[model samples]
Target: MGVFSFDDEFTANVAPARLFKAFVLDADNLFPKIAPQAAKSAETVEGNGGPGTVKKLTFPDGKYVKQKLDAVDLDNLSYSHSLIEGDVLSAELEKISHQTKFVASPDGGAIIKVNTKFYTIGDAPINEEKAKEGKEKAVGLFKLVEGYLVANPDAYN
Candidate 1:
């Protein structure tokens, strides 16, 4: 299988700790509350809510994704996971992995970095456009969460 990787970063006015707590640490409880259109529910389906644990996220459209937690470093505000199942996985792909880090900027906001890797089944070429589209969705979700945090200052603190 061939692997294609991509990197993405975005800045937000919300604090890094808050973003990490809401978006990464408490995603199952926060995502559905922040963006109901994007997520219907999220739950840990296997193991516990730690490294190697599996989480199932159901979308409003009835589609879903199974994410396996890889590493989570609270001190560094970083985490990584691999997508193992559900609609997000295409037939041509083996799995998709992501590493995300949230850093506090000088202004006390956040600078979020994400590295995504696509594992293809064979010589199948990755479609750049589709990859970009997926990234856009992720960015949108982040923005939605950012907006929620900005509006509710007491949240995720």
Candidate 2:
């Protein structure tokens, strides 16, 4: 399998604690509500989002993906997820999964970094179109979270 990397970083206007809590801790509940068209819903299938937990995401188009919580350290401000099954995009490249980290900026905002590794089979190569789609998805994540915070400033408390 060939591995392709996608990296994205953004500085959000919200505080680190706020973005982390809203985006990471409560994402299972928050994201679906905010962007129903993209994500139909998400739920805690097992455990409480700590290491060893699992979350299931249902796409609007009826596709589903299972995520295994690889590591989560609140103090370190990082968490990672590996694809367990259900979606070919993740199932095919199970080893190269998704990870996100948050770091507190000295200026009171937060730096959010997200990375995903895509895997493709055979010599045909992972289509560049798919890679472009992945990049757009990363950007959409930030926009989704930011939109939520903008609409409901007091949320995630």
lDDT of each structure? 0.92, 0.76
Model 1 CA deviation exceeding 4 Å by range: none
- Location of the lowest summed lDDT over 10 successive residues in candidate 1: 125-134
Q: In candidate 1, list every pair of residues with a backbone clash.
A: none
Candidate 2, lDDT over the whole model: 0.76
What TM-score does candidate 1 reach?
0.96
**Worst window of 10 by summed lDDT in candidate 2:** 87-96
Q: Write model 2 residue lDDT over 68-91, tens digit each, in one string.
A: 889877886787887676763633
lDDT of 1 by residue, 42-132 (tens): 9889987889999999999999999999999999999999999989888888899999999989998999999999999999988788788
TM of each candidate vs. truth = 0.96, 0.81
